[model samples]
Target chain A: MYLAKIYVTYKPSILDPQGVVIKSALERLDYQGIESVTQGKYFQVQLSGADEAAVAKEVEAFVEALLINHNTETYTYDLTEI
Target chain B: MYLAKIYVTYKPSILDPQGVVIKSALERLDYQGIESVTQGKYFQVQLSGADEAAVAKEVEAFVEALLINHNTETYTYDLTEI
Candidate 1:
C-alpha cells in the first residue's frame, strides 16, 4: 500500500479572499506580526498498489481529473510506501 | 521572516463525510486501487518575527485559538526561515 499526501492550493496569481478574512480575524483577536495567510486543501489518500511509481501515477491522474480547478488552483503530492 | 505551513485535520475518531464523498466519486470515475481518503486543511502563513522559535510559538498559539476546533481537530506546523 501507498499513502499520498496531496495539497491543492490556489495559483499565486489568484486572490484568496478566505485567507484575507482569516488574517483580518486574527488581527481583530489581537494576534500580532501576522503578515498573511493562504488556505488550501490537504488530502491523505491510501491506495493498494504494487509500486511507488504506479501509485504515484494514479494519484496524479485523479488529482488532475477531480481534485482541483485548473484555472485557479494547482496541486502537489508526496507518495510514501506504507 | 518565517513561513509556517500548518495542517489541521479531524481526529481519527471523527467521521469525514467529505472524504467519503470524494472516494465515492473517484470510484464512480473508475479509478482503481482505491483504499481510503481523508481530507484536511492546509495553511501557508507568513509571519514577521525575529527567529524561528518565536514564530513557531506564535503559530501554535493562533492555530489553537482560531484555526481549529479543539474537540474535533488537531494541528501540526512546520516553520522555516524565509
Candidate 2:
C-alpha cells in the first residue's frame, strides 16, 4: 500500500485568524519568541495499488476539489509505499 | 528561529466523516486503489528565541489546550532550527 501524507494550509496571502488566536494564547503562556503561527489541514491516505505518479495526480485533483479552498489555501503532499 | 511542524489526527476509535466523504469522492472519480483516508490538522509555528526542547514543551501545552481535542485526537511534532 501507499501512504500519502498531505498538508493543506492557508496561502501566504490569506489572513489566518485561528493562527492569530493561537499566537495570542502563546503570548498569554509567556512563551516568548514566537514570530508567527499558521494553521492547516492534514490527511493520511492509504492507497492499495498505484504508482507514485498516478497517485500524485489523483491526490492533486482530490485536494484541489475537496480538501482545500482554491482561492485561499495551497497544499503539498508526500507519498511512501507501506 | 525555529519552525515547528505539528500534526493532530483523530484516534482510530472515532469515525471520520470527512475522510469518508473524500474516499467516496475518489471512488466517484474512478480513482482506484484508495483503501482508507484519514484527516487532521497541521500547524506551522515560527519561534524566535527558545531552544528546541523548551519549544517542544511549550508547544505540547499549547496543542493540548487549543490545537487538538485531547479526548478524541492525538498529536505529534517536529522542531527544526531555521
Candidate 3:
C-alpha cells in the first residue's frame, strides 16, 4: 500500500475568508501572540497495489481533475510506502 | 517573504477518528466513491525576514513544541519564496 498526503491552499493573491474567520476567532478566544491565520486542507489517502511513480502520477491527475481548482487553489503531494 | 505550508497527519499505526467521521459525513451528504478518509491539519504561514533553512528550522521547532504530538502525529513542510 501507499500513503498520499495532499495539501490544498489558496492562491497567493487570493483572499482566504475561512482563514480570516479563524484568525478572528483565535483572537476572540485570547490566544496570545497570534498575528494571522491562513487555512488549508489536508487529505491522507491510502492506495492499494500502486508503485510510487504510478501513485504519484495518479495523485497529480486526481488533484488536477477533481481535488483542487487550479485557478483558485494549488495542491501538492508526498507519497510513502506503507 | 517566505510561505510555509505545513501538513500534519496522524501516525500510521494510529486510528484517525476525524477522518472516519468525515468519510461518514461525506457519504451521508451523497458524495460518492469515497472508500475511506483520513483527515489532517494544514497551516499556511507567511514569514517575514527569514531564509528558507531558518524558516524550516523554526517550523520544525514550532511543530515539535506546539503543532503536533510526536507520538501521535507527524508533519512535513514546503517552503516557497514570494
Which candidate would rank higher by lDDT, 2 or 3?
A: 2
Clashing pairs in 1: none
Clashing pairs in 2: A33-B48
> What is candidate 2's DockQ?
0.83
Q: Indicate which candidate wins on TM-score.
A: 1
lDDT of 1 at B57: 80
Native-referenced Cα lDDT, model 3: 0.73
Tens digit per residue, CA lDDT, model 1, A1-82: 9999999999999999889999999999998899999999999999998988878889999999999999999988888888
- lDDT per residue for candidate 3 within A1-82, as digits (tens), equals 7777888889889999977875566556544334556778899876664467776776676667656788899877888887
Which pairs of residues collide in candidate 3?
A: none
Write model 1 residue lDDT over B1-82, tens digit each, in one string.
Answer: 8899998889999999999999999999999988999999999999998877778888888999899999999888888888
User: What TM-score, over all chains together, does every model reach?
Assistant: 0.96, 0.92, 0.57
Which 10 consecutive residues of model 2 chain A have the lowest summed lDDT? Answer: A49-58
Per-residue lDDT of model 2, residues B1-82, tens digit only = 8899999999989998989988898889887788999888999999876577887887787778778887889989988999
The superposed Cα distance between candidate 2 and the true structure at residue A25, in angstroms, equals 1.9
DockQ of candidate 1?
A: 0.87
Ranking by TM-score: 1, 2, 3
In model 1, where do residues sit more than 4 Å from their true spots? Answer: none
The models' CA-based lDDT, in order, is: 0.92, 0.87, 0.73
Against the true chain A, what TM-score does chain A of candidate 1 give?
A: 0.95
